[model samples]
Target: MPDTAGLAVRTLTPDAPAEAPPVLLVHGFGSDGAGDWIDTGVAAALTAAGRTVIIPDLRGHGASPAPESAAEATAPALAADLLAAADAAGAATFDIAGYSLGARVAWAVAAAAPDRVERSVLGGLSPVEPFTAVDIEALHRAVREGAQCPDPFTAAIAGMVSAHGDRAPGLALCVEGLRDTPFAGGAWDAKVLPVFVVGENDELTRGIDGLAGSLGARLVTVPGAHHEVLGGPHFRDTVLDVLAR
Candidate 1:
């Protein structure tokens, strides 16, 4: 559906009334709402079980609009785009699940407007102390050059997950976010949420566990590398587990 970001959102909803509330699946950078995660069967299985699913292409990724100015690519800005989608699509409220960069943006969205989101699952990232100029410059560089990892260590970490097709756009968006956080100006006091999923083998995601725990969120560890879990069979069940409640 059309939204503030002019982004296309993919959805899977049952023809019959759904048993669970809608769940929005946000894929990491370089991937679209569908290719990044929904196509993995996560969204489909949930909808099959009588749940409504919403998947959005964050701005600058996939079919979503890419901002000319750097300011438009931050997580907070992306969150605003989501709100526009919610309004344009007439969504009263819904659960959100974000993976990697999308997960970070989901955090901003739910944190900024807790009531607007029924429940939230941030799949790949943890909250960090406020960003610095170095972070901003790094984001700018990464956004401009899609594959530049700061160090061999980070590069190796990323290379392991690069086999997944959606990583490209994710890298680009990460650059943008690092250069300037969409929610930099806003403060989100991570409210309570039902659950958070982290990849057992992913060090990056493990860091996010600390963030989830601080929010008093439930944690479920899925087996596999970061990208694998996003594309894994159990992902759908883990995602729906939050809504199954």
Candidate 2:
């Protein structure tokens, strides 16, 4: 484990000659690197295939320290942290694989360091910002007071945050930070076209087709819901195949 600034990163070295550029695996909201990538064997599989794998526990998630304010936890700030992690790994350029909120962060990373990102696989990403629709005040109230969130969407998000136990407050702050810097897919300017992967049953990414087309990116529909997609062999194989190309 190497600490880059405040981020705790887990690096996996390949057993043989490196077949591809270093890959950064960004995890989703309410979940850390281990829970999303490591536990599902994606990290090990990538390593076995001769790729150096870099996994960062994003700020306020896993071993990384929580941000004191929403400003500090913004997507751009997280993107900067990831670039620093790549720098620490000595990777001048790399590939990226991110899921859900991680996908949004990956978009930020690609935009910030367009020249450094060789390719990207964005999973479960929505055409519009998901958090912009969330009721932030209600979310905070739920986290702080154990009150029920009024909106069904906010309630669902609240449930996910609650699953993390004591980290609910920090996660709530992260959501606020993300909501502050919402995703606008059409505004993306990165030259490197990404491969967008979504589950057929994932309502979150329902309108991603339009965005993907505008970006001239490829879209691959996999076989599960948003949460189940990452852990499935379809996702792993799709990512592996894409990166190998």
Candidate 3:
């Protein structure tokens, strides 16, 4: 275990090489790598395929220390931390996969250093940025008013964030940090091997195909909604297929 710019990271190496590049798994907002990857069986599957797995608890989540300043919580900054995790894992170049918010950071990583990414799977992502219009102040008010907020999802997340105790404010700053972090069609141009996976019923489906085409990446549609997509067999199979290629 080591720190990547204040982020906590864990690496799981396979007993044998399946000829696959080491893989990095980045989790979504409010969630950590273990909760998103390991608990979902993604990490185990990758290891079963003989690929080493690098899982980092992004700053402000899990065991990682939260960023006291919004500047330290930007997506690009998080992307840089991923590279640090790669260095810790002794991987100069590696395969990568990320879900939701992590996918945004992954795009930044590949955009900044395409040569270091052998292949990348962007899951639960779309061309439209999700946090751009999120009303952080309203969400904060809802949290303070209790869990009986108007948006159930927001309330649930507020609960999770607040459960971390004093880390809530930092998490709020993180939300603000990512608010303007663009994943718009032209914001990132990654030439690395990239793919997109989304739930067929996901609202995030808009512009995903176009974004994938722009990157010359394949788009895989799996059954289920946004959060449920990662648990589907289609997602698992698609990830393995892409990595195998």
Candidate 4:
């Protein structure tokens, strides 16, 4: 099939424009469009500040389609979704930002199609967290066996992610993507001067810093846990600084 990147895209169009262009937000793995940022109030915050915003549920995460194979879910494929979504959102060109897994996809998109994007804020990822070969055989076994655990977070520390997915047909697309993309953790083809944000004390922070240093980018520490950083004032201030630059 054609490059799977950018094939899946969703938008949250705004009614007003701020001094700057609209901001597209991409959520991390295991979350959807609304709960990802809309429910978190990030979308509303920027909108209130007069910045038009667009949020997408990156592949294997939300409304976007999950490719049947990891090859289809590669960073290139998911970046394609940003393009399609931006076009659909009526943003001929735009600034973009993403969190965690979403941040990775954003990097992929910016790397693959820099001309289409102006600036980007990548939150919660570091280059040190290199993507490794997956134990797909074991992962598939867990899925087929209907596994459940109260302390899955412990395992997630090693990227052993698990979630109760939707029965809706759309979820299958995302799930398939999760199964396919082993997150071969490294910067792909990208040269954008991205604004990277991470939580202080986050194990992932150093990794993100490493990535930024390699790319001639800068880093911002938001002083919170990984998931909650997006909600705090630091989140907005950091983003505004990036956009202002």
Clashing residue pair totals per candidate (backbone < 3 A): 7, 0, 0, 16
- Please give, for residues 72-144, the per-residue lDDT of candidate 4 as tens digits: 5666677777777776667766788888878877877776677767878888875643333334444444454
Alpha-carbon RMSD to native, per candidate:
4.5, 1.6, 2.8, 4.7
Candidate 3, residue 144: Cα displacement in angstroms equals: 6.3
Which parts of model 3 have CA positions greater than 4 angstroms off?
1-3, 140-166, 187-191
Question: How many Å off is the CA of 50 in candidate 4?
Answer: 2.4
The number of the candidate with the highest TM-score is 2
CA lDDT, every model vs. true structure: 0.65, 0.89, 0.80, 0.64
TM-score of 2: 0.94
TM-score of each: 0.78, 0.94, 0.87, 0.78
Worst 10 residues of 4 by lDDT: 149-158
- List, residue by residue over 107-205, the lDDT tens digit for candidate 3: 888877787888888899867766666566765665555535566556665676677667777777777777757565564444465788999889976
Clashing residue pairs found in predicted model 1: 29-169, 29-170, 30-169, 30-170, 75-182, 76-182, 139-179
Rank the candidate models, highest TM-score first. Answer: 2, 3, 1, 4
Candidate number with greatest lDDT: 2
